[model samples]
Target: MKKRFCIASLLLLCLTSPWIAVAQTVILESPVRVVTSSDRSIFPESWLSPDINAEAEVLQESQIEPSRRVLYKVMKKYPGHILARNLETIYVLHRLKYKGISASGTNSRRNVYVVNRGSRERYTDAWIERTFHAEFSSKLLRNFPQYLDNDVWKKANVESFKYGVSGVKSVKQKKALKMFDPSLHAEGFLYAYAKSTLENDFNSIAEQLFLGDSRFWSVVNKHQRIKEKTDLVIAFYHKIDPKFSRSFFVSLAEVESAEIG
Candidate 1:
Protein backbone atom coordinates (compact mmCIF):
# COMPACT_ATOMS: atom_id res chain seq x y z
CA MET A 1 0.00 0.00 0.00
CA LYS A 2 2.83 2.44 0.77
CA LYS A 3 4.51 1.76 -2.58
CA ARG A 4 1.25 2.17 -4.43
CA PHE A 5 0.52 5.53 -2.76
CA CYS A 6 3.99 6.85 -3.65
CA ILE A 7 3.50 5.69 -7.27
CA ALA A 8 0.16 7.47 -7.51
CA SER A 9 1.62 10.66 -6.04
CA LEU A 10 4.47 10.59 -8.57
CA LEU A 11 2.07 10.11 -11.43
CA LEU A 12 -0.02 13.06 -10.29
CA LEU A 13 3.01 15.34 -9.98
CA CYS A 14 4.25 14.36 -13.43
CA LEU A 15 0.87 15.07 -14.94
CA THR A 16 0.68 18.48 -13.26
CA SER A 17 4.30 19.43 -13.96
CA PRO A 18 3.64 20.60 -17.50
CA TRP A 19 0.93 22.96 -16.34
CA ILE A 20 3.12 24.18 -13.51
CA ALA A 21 5.97 24.97 -15.90
CA VAL A 22 3.64 26.75 -18.29
CA ALA A 23 2.21 28.80 -15.44
CA GLN A 24 5.66 29.78 -14.17
CA THR A 25 6.99 30.78 -17.60
CA VAL A 26 3.76 32.53 -18.46
CA ILE A 27 3.76 34.56 -15.29
CA LEU A 28 3.17 38.04 -16.73
CA GLU A 29 3.05 41.50 -15.31
CA SER A 30 -0.46 43.04 -15.05
CA PRO A 31 -1.91 39.57 -15.45
CA VAL A 32 -1.89 40.26 -19.13
CA ARG A 33 -4.84 38.68 -20.84
CA VAL A 34 -3.49 39.88 -24.16
CA VAL A 35 0.04 38.66 -23.42
CA THR A 36 -1.39 35.36 -22.34
CA SER A 37 -2.74 34.91 -25.89
CA SER A 38 0.16 32.70 -26.81
CA ASP A 39 0.18 29.10 -28.15
CA ARG A 40 -1.68 30.14 -31.29
CA SER A 41 -0.46 28.89 -34.70
CA ILE A 42 -1.27 32.22 -36.30
CA PHE A 43 2.23 33.58 -35.76
CA PRO A 44 4.88 32.57 -38.23
CA GLU A 45 7.29 29.79 -37.24
CA SER A 46 10.08 32.39 -37.15
CA TRP A 47 8.92 34.83 -34.38
CA LEU A 48 10.59 32.58 -31.68
CA SER A 49 9.00 34.25 -28.62
CA PRO A 50 5.59 33.86 -27.04
CA ASP A 51 2.66 35.79 -28.56
CA ILE A 52 2.06 38.43 -25.94
CA ASN A 53 5.74 39.13 -25.58
CA ALA A 54 5.90 39.47 -29.35
CA GLU A 55 2.92 41.78 -29.14
CA ALA A 56 4.71 43.95 -26.61
CA GLU A 57 7.90 43.75 -28.65
CA VAL A 58 6.04 44.69 -31.80
CA LEU A 59 4.38 47.64 -30.11
CA GLN A 60 7.76 48.78 -28.83
CA GLU A 61 9.60 48.41 -32.10
CA SER A 62 7.08 48.91 -34.91
CA GLN A 63 6.24 52.26 -36.47
CA ILE A 64 2.49 51.69 -36.24
CA GLU A 65 0.68 54.87 -35.24
CA PRO A 66 0.83 56.11 -31.65
CA SER A 67 -2.94 56.05 -31.63
CA ARG A 68 -2.86 52.36 -32.56
CA ARG A 69 -0.43 51.50 -29.76
CA VAL A 70 -2.63 53.25 -27.23
CA LEU A 71 -5.70 51.51 -28.62
CA TYR A 72 -4.07 48.08 -28.52
CA LYS A 73 -2.82 48.64 -24.98
CA VAL A 74 -6.29 49.63 -23.89
CA MET A 75 -7.67 46.56 -25.64
CA LYS A 76 -5.13 44.36 -23.90
CA LYS A 77 -6.22 45.74 -20.54
CA TYR A 78 -9.92 46.23 -21.11
CA PRO A 79 -13.07 44.15 -20.87
CA GLY A 80 -13.37 43.68 -24.66
CA HIS A 81 -10.08 41.81 -24.88
CA ILE A 82 -10.08 42.32 -28.63
CA LEU A 83 -6.46 41.34 -29.11
CA ALA A 84 -7.49 37.71 -29.07
CA ARG A 85 -9.25 38.27 -32.38
CA ASN A 86 -6.53 40.47 -33.88
CA LEU A 87 -4.00 37.75 -34.60
CA GLU A 88 -3.98 38.49 -38.32
CA THR A 89 -3.95 42.20 -37.58
CA ILE A 90 -0.85 41.71 -35.48
CA TYR A 91 0.74 39.61 -38.21
CA VAL A 92 0.04 42.22 -40.87
CA LEU A 93 1.35 44.97 -38.64
CA HIS A 94 4.49 42.93 -38.08
CA ARG A 95 4.96 42.46 -41.82
CA LEU A 96 4.26 46.14 -42.40
CA LYS A 97 6.84 46.98 -39.77
CA TYR A 98 9.28 44.62 -41.45
CA LYS A 99 8.72 46.53 -44.70
CA GLY A 100 9.27 49.90 -42.94
CA ILE A 101 5.85 51.15 -44.10
CA SER A 102 4.95 52.33 -40.62
CA ALA A 103 8.04 54.53 -40.49
CA SER A 104 7.13 56.48 -43.60
CA GLY A 105 5.32 59.60 -42.41
CA THR A 106 4.27 60.51 -45.95
CA ASN A 107 3.20 56.96 -46.79
CA SER A 108 1.30 56.52 -43.56
CA ARG A 109 -0.69 59.73 -44.07
CA ARG A 110 -1.43 59.05 -47.72
CA ASN A 111 -2.89 55.55 -47.73
CA VAL A 112 -4.27 53.98 -44.54
CA TYR A 113 -7.98 54.01 -43.77
CA VAL A 114 -8.18 54.66 -40.06
CA VAL A 115 -11.46 53.97 -38.34
CA ASN A 116 -12.18 54.93 -34.74
CA ARG A 117 -13.38 52.29 -32.32
CA GLY A 118 -13.78 51.88 -28.59
CA SER A 119 -11.12 50.05 -26.59
CA ARG A 120 -13.69 47.59 -25.32
CA GLU A 121 -15.06 46.82 -28.76
CA ARG A 122 -13.92 44.10 -31.12
CA TYR A 123 -13.26 44.13 -34.88
CA THR A 124 -12.96 41.32 -37.39
CA ASP A 125 -9.79 40.27 -39.25
CA ALA A 126 -11.66 40.70 -42.52
CA TRP A 127 -12.52 44.26 -41.57
CA ILE A 128 -8.93 44.98 -40.65
CA GLU A 129 -7.49 43.08 -43.62
CA ARG A 130 -9.80 44.81 -46.07
CA THR A 131 -8.32 48.09 -44.92
CA PHE A 132 -4.74 46.86 -44.95
CA HIS A 133 -5.18 44.86 -48.14
CA ALA A 134 -5.36 48.16 -49.96
CA GLU A 135 -1.75 48.75 -49.06
CA PHE A 136 -0.79 45.42 -50.56
CA SER A 137 -3.01 45.73 -53.63
CA SER A 138 -2.02 49.31 -54.19
CA LYS A 139 1.61 48.32 -54.07
CA LEU A 140 0.84 45.41 -56.35
CA LEU A 141 -0.96 47.71 -58.75
CA ARG A 142 1.57 50.54 -58.68
CA ASN A 143 4.95 48.83 -58.78
CA PHE A 144 5.05 46.61 -61.79
CA PRO A 145 8.55 45.35 -62.50
CA GLN A 146 9.40 46.12 -66.18
CA TYR A 147 5.94 47.68 -66.52
CA LEU A 148 6.70 49.76 -69.64
CA ASP A 149 4.83 47.32 -71.89
CA ASN A 150 1.03 47.63 -71.39
CA ASP A 151 1.51 49.14 -67.97
CA VAL A 152 -1.68 48.55 -65.95
CA TRP A 153 -0.91 51.32 -63.45
CA LYS A 154 -0.27 53.94 -66.09
CA LYS A 155 -3.16 52.69 -68.21
CA ALA A 156 -5.57 52.87 -65.27
CA ASN A 157 -4.41 56.39 -64.45
CA VAL A 158 -4.94 57.54 -68.03
CA GLU A 159 -8.38 55.89 -68.15
CA SER A 160 -9.52 57.36 -64.84
CA PHE A 161 -8.50 60.82 -66.01
CA LYS A 162 -10.11 60.17 -69.41
CA TYR A 163 -13.33 59.03 -67.74
CA GLY A 164 -13.42 62.34 -65.91
CA VAL A 165 -12.40 60.88 -62.55
CA SER A 166 -11.58 64.24 -60.91
CA GLY A 167 -11.69 66.01 -64.26
CA VAL A 168 -8.93 65.15 -66.77
CA LYS A 169 -5.35 63.96 -66.23
CA SER A 170 -3.31 67.16 -65.90
CA VAL A 171 0.41 67.86 -65.91
CA LYS A 172 0.38 67.20 -62.16
CA GLN A 173 -1.28 63.80 -62.70
CA LYS A 174 1.98 61.89 -62.36
CA LYS A 175 2.83 63.73 -59.16
CA ALA A 176 -0.68 63.27 -57.76
CA LEU A 177 -0.75 59.49 -58.47
CA LYS A 178 2.73 59.10 -56.94
CA MET A 179 1.44 60.40 -53.62
CA PHE A 180 -0.26 57.94 -51.23
CA ASP A 181 -3.59 59.80 -51.31
CA PRO A 182 -4.92 58.07 -54.47
CA SER A 183 -5.29 54.74 -52.61
CA LEU A 184 -8.15 55.81 -50.35
CA HIS A 185 -10.77 54.62 -52.81
CA ALA A 186 -13.26 52.02 -51.53
CA GLU A 187 -13.94 50.95 -55.12
CA GLY A 188 -14.88 47.35 -55.79
CA PHE A 189 -12.57 44.67 -57.26
CA LEU A 190 -9.78 47.10 -58.11
CA TYR A 191 -7.71 44.82 -60.31
CA ALA A 192 -10.75 43.72 -62.32
CA TYR A 193 -11.95 47.30 -62.62
CA ALA A 194 -8.58 48.39 -63.92
CA LYS A 195 -8.43 45.60 -66.45
CA SER A 196 -12.08 45.83 -67.43
CA THR A 197 -12.06 49.57 -67.96
CA LEU A 198 -9.19 49.03 -70.35
CA GLU A 199 -11.51 46.87 -72.49
CA ASN A 200 -12.85 48.78 -75.50
CA ASP A 201 -16.60 48.22 -74.93
CA PHE A 202 -16.87 46.78 -71.40
CA ASN A 203 -16.91 50.27 -69.88
CA SER A 204 -18.10 50.97 -66.30
CA ILE A 205 -20.59 48.09 -66.08
CA ALA A 206 -17.79 45.55 -65.83
CA GLU A 207 -16.35 47.42 -62.87
CA GLN A 208 -19.73 48.09 -61.32
CA LEU A 209 -20.25 44.47 -60.29
CA PHE A 210 -17.63 45.13 -57.65
CA LEU A 211 -19.81 47.79 -56.08
CA GLY A 212 -22.04 44.98 -54.77
CA ASP A 213 -24.92 46.24 -56.93
CA SER A 214 -27.64 44.68 -59.20
CA ARG A 215 -28.28 47.38 -61.78
CA PHE A 216 -24.90 46.89 -63.33
CA TRP A 217 -25.54 43.18 -63.83
CA SER A 218 -28.86 44.03 -65.50
CA VAL A 219 -27.06 46.33 -67.85
CA VAL A 220 -24.51 43.60 -68.39
CA ASN A 221 -27.12 40.89 -69.04
CA LYS A 222 -29.08 43.08 -71.44
CA HIS A 223 -26.21 44.71 -73.26
CA GLN A 224 -22.99 42.69 -72.99
CA ARG A 225 -21.19 39.34 -72.99
CA ILE A 226 -17.79 39.93 -71.44
CA LYS A 227 -17.54 36.79 -69.28
CA GLU A 228 -13.87 37.50 -68.49
CA LYS A 229 -14.78 40.46 -66.32
CA THR A 230 -16.75 38.19 -64.00
CA ASP A 231 -13.84 35.79 -63.98
CA LEU A 232 -11.53 38.66 -63.05
CA VAL A 233 -13.79 39.74 -60.20
CA ILE A 234 -13.74 36.21 -58.82
CA ALA A 235 -9.96 36.06 -59.09
CA PHE A 236 -9.36 39.49 -57.52
CA TYR A 237 -11.71 38.91 -54.57
CA HIS A 238 -9.91 35.64 -53.87
CA LYS A 239 -6.70 37.67 -53.72
CA ILE A 240 -8.27 40.07 -51.20
CA ASP A 241 -10.13 37.27 -49.45
CA PRO A 242 -8.49 33.87 -49.80
CA LYS A 243 -11.61 31.89 -49.01
CA PHE A 244 -13.92 33.74 -51.39
CA SER A 245 -15.61 31.67 -54.11
CA ARG A 246 -17.19 32.59 -57.43
CA SER A 247 -20.59 31.82 -55.88
CA PHE A 248 -20.02 34.36 -53.10
CA PHE A 249 -19.66 37.46 -55.26
CA VAL A 250 -22.02 35.90 -57.75
CA SER A 251 -24.70 35.70 -55.08
CA LEU A 252 -24.13 39.29 -54.01
CA ALA A 253 -24.15 40.46 -57.63
CA GLU A 254 -27.16 38.28 -58.36
CA VAL A 255 -29.12 40.15 -55.73
CA GLU A 256 -28.34 43.47 -57.39
CA SER A 257 -28.78 42.02 -60.89
CA ALA A 258 -32.17 40.61 -59.91
CA GLU A 259 -33.35 43.89 -58.42
CA ILE A 260 -32.57 45.83 -61.57
CA GLY A 261 -33.62 43.06 -63.98
Candidate 2:
Protein backbone atom coordinates (compact mmCIF):
# COMPACT_ATOMS: atom_id res chain seq x y z
CA MET A 1 0.00 0.00 0.00
CA LYS A 2 1.14 3.68 -0.55
CA LYS A 3 1.02 4.33 3.27
CA ARG A 4 3.31 1.34 3.94
CA PHE A 5 5.75 2.52 1.21
CA CYS A 6 5.92 6.04 2.71
CA ILE A 7 6.69 4.68 6.18
CA ALA A 8 9.44 2.42 4.78
CA SER A 9 11.00 5.31 2.86
CA LEU A 10 11.13 7.50 5.98
CA LEU A 11 12.75 4.71 7.96
CA LEU A 12 15.36 4.14 5.25
CA LEU A 13 16.22 7.83 5.08
CA CYS A 14 16.84 8.02 8.82
CA LEU A 15 18.97 4.88 8.81
CA THR A 16 21.13 5.92 5.86
CA SER A 17 21.57 9.64 6.52
CA PRO A 18 25.07 11.00 6.85
CA TRP A 19 24.10 12.87 10.03
CA ILE A 20 23.05 9.64 11.66
CA ALA A 21 26.32 8.00 10.67
CA VAL A 22 28.37 10.90 12.01
CA ALA A 23 26.43 10.95 15.25
CA GLN A 24 27.13 7.28 15.80
CA THR A 25 30.89 7.78 15.34
CA VAL A 26 31.08 10.44 18.07
CA ILE A 27 33.39 9.62 20.99
CA LEU A 28 31.30 9.49 24.15
CA GLU A 29 34.04 9.72 26.75
CA SER A 30 35.11 13.22 25.73
CA PRO A 31 33.43 16.21 24.17
CA VAL A 32 35.92 16.22 21.32
CA ARG A 33 35.70 13.67 18.52
CA VAL A 34 38.43 12.41 16.18
CA VAL A 35 37.34 13.03 12.61
CA THR A 36 39.11 11.18 9.79
CA SER A 37 36.89 12.05 6.84
CA SER A 38 38.00 14.67 4.30
CA ASP A 39 34.46 15.55 3.45
CA ARG A 40 33.82 19.27 3.91
CA SER A 41 30.37 18.66 5.28
CA ILE A 42 31.82 16.72 8.16
CA PHE A 43 33.48 19.90 9.48
CA PRO A 44 31.64 22.76 11.06
CA GLU A 45 31.13 25.89 8.91
CA SER A 46 33.01 28.12 11.34
CA TRP A 47 36.08 25.90 11.24
CA LEU A 48 36.18 25.91 7.45
CA SER A 49 35.63 29.63 7.03
CA PRO A 50 38.95 30.76 8.50
CA ASP A 51 41.12 28.40 6.45
CA ILE A 52 39.46 28.21 3.08
CA ASN A 53 42.66 27.24 1.25
CA ALA A 54 43.54 24.38 3.57
CA GLU A 55 43.86 20.99 1.89
CA ALA A 56 43.78 17.62 3.62
CA GLU A 57 43.71 13.95 2.76
CA VAL A 58 41.60 11.38 4.52
CA LEU A 59 43.41 9.51 7.28
CA GLN A 60 44.15 5.87 6.59
CA GLU A 61 41.89 3.40 8.38
CA SER A 62 44.88 1.54 9.80
CA GLN A 63 46.26 4.69 11.41
CA ILE A 64 43.01 5.71 13.09
CA GLU A 65 43.41 3.57 16.20
CA PRO A 66 46.93 4.75 17.04
CA SER A 67 46.09 8.34 16.20
CA ARG A 68 43.00 8.27 18.38
CA ARG A 69 44.96 6.73 21.24
CA VAL A 70 47.51 9.55 21.18
CA LEU A 71 44.86 12.22 20.81
CA TYR A 72 42.78 10.87 23.65
CA LYS A 73 45.80 10.72 25.91
CA VAL A 74 46.65 14.36 25.18
CA MET A 75 43.07 15.40 25.74
CA LYS A 76 43.00 13.60 29.08
CA LYS A 77 45.67 15.97 30.42
CA TYR A 78 43.31 18.91 30.36
CA PRO A 79 40.53 19.53 32.80
CA GLY A 80 37.21 18.11 31.66
CA HIS A 81 35.52 21.50 31.88
CA ILE A 82 38.21 23.19 29.80
CA LEU A 83 38.00 20.51 27.13
CA ALA A 84 34.21 20.63 27.11
CA ARG A 85 34.03 24.39 26.81
CA ASN A 86 36.87 25.00 24.31
CA LEU A 87 37.36 21.97 22.10
CA GLU A 88 34.85 20.27 19.84
CA THR A 89 36.74 18.12 17.32
CA ILE A 90 40.15 16.99 16.08
CA TYR A 91 40.41 16.14 12.37
CA VAL A 92 43.11 13.60 11.65
CA LEU A 93 44.67 13.57 8.20
CA HIS A 94 47.33 11.71 6.26
CA ARG A 95 48.53 15.08 5.01
CA LEU A 96 47.54 18.70 5.65
CA LYS A 97 48.77 21.83 3.86
CA TYR A 98 47.70 25.40 4.43
CA LYS A 99 48.31 28.10 1.83
CA GLY A 100 50.60 25.66 0.02
CA ILE A 101 52.90 24.96 2.97
CA SER A 102 52.98 21.63 4.72
CA ALA A 103 52.25 21.86 8.44
CA SER A 104 52.31 19.28 11.18
CA GLY A 105 49.18 20.74 12.70
CA THR A 106 46.92 23.81 12.93
CA ASN A 107 43.81 24.87 14.84
CA SER A 108 40.79 27.06 14.96
CA ARG A 109 38.86 28.02 18.08
CA ARG A 110 37.04 24.73 18.44
CA ASN A 111 38.76 22.35 16.04
CA VAL A 112 42.30 21.11 15.30
CA TYR A 113 43.88 19.66 12.16
CA VAL A 114 46.82 17.29 12.50
CA VAL A 115 48.73 15.15 10.07
CA ASN A 116 48.89 11.62 11.36
CA ARG A 117 51.93 9.43 10.74
CA GLY A 118 51.63 7.45 7.54
CA SER A 119 53.39 4.21 6.66
CA ARG A 120 55.98 6.10 4.65
CA GLU A 121 56.14 9.17 6.91
CA ARG A 122 58.99 9.68 9.35
CA TYR A 123 56.88 11.30 12.09
CA THR A 124 57.25 9.69 15.49
CA ASP A 125 54.57 9.10 18.11
CA ALA A 126 56.24 11.75 20.27
CA TRP A 127 56.02 14.26 17.43
CA ILE A 128 52.33 13.56 16.92
CA GLU A 129 51.57 14.00 20.63
CA ARG A 130 53.58 17.22 20.72
CA THR A 131 51.72 18.51 17.69
CA PHE A 132 48.37 17.92 19.37
CA HIS A 133 49.39 19.72 22.55
CA ALA A 134 51.05 22.59 20.68
CA GLU A 135 48.13 23.25 18.38
CA PHE A 136 45.51 22.86 21.11
CA SER A 137 47.37 25.28 23.36
CA SER A 138 47.45 27.83 20.56
CA LYS A 139 43.67 27.54 20.35
CA LEU A 140 43.37 27.96 24.10
CA LEU A 141 45.64 31.00 24.08
CA ARG A 142 43.59 32.61 21.36
CA ASN A 143 40.40 31.88 23.27
CA PHE A 144 41.76 33.21 26.56
CA PRO A 145 44.42 35.82 25.91
CA GLN A 146 43.75 37.53 29.22
CA TYR A 147 45.29 34.62 31.07
CA LEU A 148 48.69 35.27 29.43
CA ASP A 149 50.11 38.71 29.94
CA ASN A 150 52.26 39.62 26.94
CA ASP A 151 54.34 42.10 28.95
CA VAL A 152 55.01 39.54 31.66
CA TRP A 153 55.95 36.92 29.09
CA LYS A 154 58.25 39.38 27.36
CA LYS A 155 59.85 40.40 30.63
CA ALA A 156 60.95 36.79 31.03
CA ASN A 157 62.96 37.10 27.80
CA VAL A 158 66.35 38.79 27.34
CA GLU A 159 66.08 42.60 27.30
CA SER A 160 66.84 43.00 23.58
CA PHE A 161 64.92 39.98 22.28
CA LYS A 162 62.13 40.39 19.78
CA TYR A 163 59.92 37.70 18.22
CA GLY A 164 59.62 37.38 14.48
CA VAL A 165 56.60 38.72 12.64
CA SER A 166 54.81 35.42 12.49
CA GLY A 167 55.33 31.68 12.50
CA VAL A 168 54.31 31.47 8.85
CA LYS A 169 56.86 34.09 7.85
CA SER A 170 59.56 32.31 9.84
CA VAL A 171 58.74 29.09 7.97
CA LYS A 172 58.69 30.82 4.62
CA GLN A 173 62.12 32.25 5.27
CA LYS A 174 63.39 28.78 6.30
CA LYS A 175 64.41 29.81 9.79
CA ALA A 176 65.34 27.03 12.17
CA LEU A 177 62.30 25.75 14.07
CA LYS A 178 63.82 22.92 15.92
CA MET A 179 61.80 21.65 18.90
CA PHE A 180 64.54 22.02 21.51
CA ASP A 181 67.95 23.57 22.07
CA PRO A 182 69.58 23.78 25.48
CA SER A 183 71.43 26.95 24.44
CA LEU A 184 68.16 28.79 23.83
CA HIS A 185 66.85 27.78 27.26
CA ALA A 186 69.27 30.27 28.79
CA GLU A 187 67.47 32.97 26.77
CA GLY A 188 64.00 31.90 27.94
CA PHE A 189 63.21 30.03 24.71
CA LEU A 190 62.75 26.34 24.16
CA TYR A 191 64.14 26.38 20.60
CA ALA A 192 64.66 28.40 17.45
CA TYR A 193 60.94 28.03 16.69
CA ALA A 194 59.98 29.95 19.80
CA LYS A 195 61.46 33.12 18.32
CA SER A 196 59.03 32.96 15.39
CA THR A 197 56.24 34.60 17.38
CA LEU A 198 54.87 35.09 20.84
CA GLU A 199 52.32 32.41 20.12
CA ASN A 200 55.05 30.07 18.95
CA ASP A 201 56.96 30.74 22.16
CA PHE A 202 53.88 29.92 24.17
CA ASN A 203 53.26 26.80 22.08
CA SER A 204 56.81 25.57 22.57
CA ILE A 205 56.46 25.75 26.34
CA ALA A 206 52.95 24.29 26.24
CA GLU A 207 54.00 21.24 24.24
CA GLN A 208 56.76 20.47 26.72
CA LEU A 209 54.47 21.16 29.66
CA PHE A 210 51.84 18.77 28.40
CA LEU A 211 54.55 16.30 27.43
CA GLY A 212 55.84 16.45 31.03
CA ASP A 213 59.21 14.94 30.21
CA SER A 214 62.41 15.07 32.29
CA ARG A 215 64.47 16.83 29.62
CA PHE A 216 62.13 19.82 29.81
CA TRP A 217 62.37 19.99 33.60
CA SER A 218 66.17 19.68 33.57
CA VAL A 219 66.45 22.80 31.39
CA VAL A 220 63.85 24.68 33.45
CA ASN A 221 65.68 23.88 36.65
CA LYS A 222 69.11 24.97 35.35
CA HIS A 223 68.15 28.10 33.43
CA GLN A 224 66.69 31.11 35.22
CA ARG A 225 65.16 32.57 32.05
CA ILE A 226 63.56 29.29 31.12
CA LYS A 227 62.35 28.95 34.69
CA GLU A 228 60.78 32.42 34.54
CA LYS A 229 59.04 31.56 31.28
CA THR A 230 57.94 28.20 32.66
CA ASP A 231 56.54 29.90 35.72
CA LEU A 232 54.51 32.27 33.55
CA VAL A 233 53.18 29.35 31.52
CA ILE A 234 52.22 27.57 34.73
CA ALA A 235 50.47 30.68 35.98
CA PHE A 236 48.61 31.03 32.68
CA TYR A 237 47.22 27.50 32.82
CA HIS A 238 46.49 27.85 36.52
CA LYS A 239 44.42 30.94 35.87
CA ILE A 240 42.41 29.01 33.35
CA ASP A 241 41.88 26.21 35.88
CA PRO A 242 43.02 26.22 39.48
CA LYS A 243 43.70 22.48 39.28
CA PHE A 244 46.59 23.20 36.85
CA SER A 245 49.15 24.12 39.52
CA ARG A 246 52.94 23.88 39.66
CA SER A 247 52.73 20.78 41.87
CA PHE A 248 50.19 19.26 39.49
CA PHE A 249 52.60 19.70 36.59
CA VAL A 250 55.56 18.36 38.61
CA SER A 251 53.53 15.28 39.50
CA LEU A 252 52.50 14.91 35.86
CA ALA A 253 56.12 15.04 34.80
CA GLU A 254 57.02 12.43 37.43
CA VAL A 255 54.31 10.07 36.25
CA GLU A 256 55.30 10.48 32.62
CA SER A 257 58.95 9.86 33.41
CA ALA A 258 58.06 6.76 35.41
CA GLU A 259 56.07 5.39 32.48
CA ILE A 260 58.96 6.09 30.12
CA GLY A 261 61.36 4.34 32.50
Assess candidate 1 and give its lDDT: 0.32
Candidate 2 global lDDT? 0.79
lDDT of 2 at 65: 78
- The stretch of ten residues in a row with the least summed lDDT in candidate 1 is 98-107
Off by over 4 Å in 2: 1-29, 41-52
Residue 173, model 2: lDDT of: 85
Let me know the TM-score candidate 1 reaches against the reference structure.
0.27
- lDDT by residue (tens digit), candidate 1, 183-212: 322232222223222321122322243334
TM-score of each: 0.27, 0.83
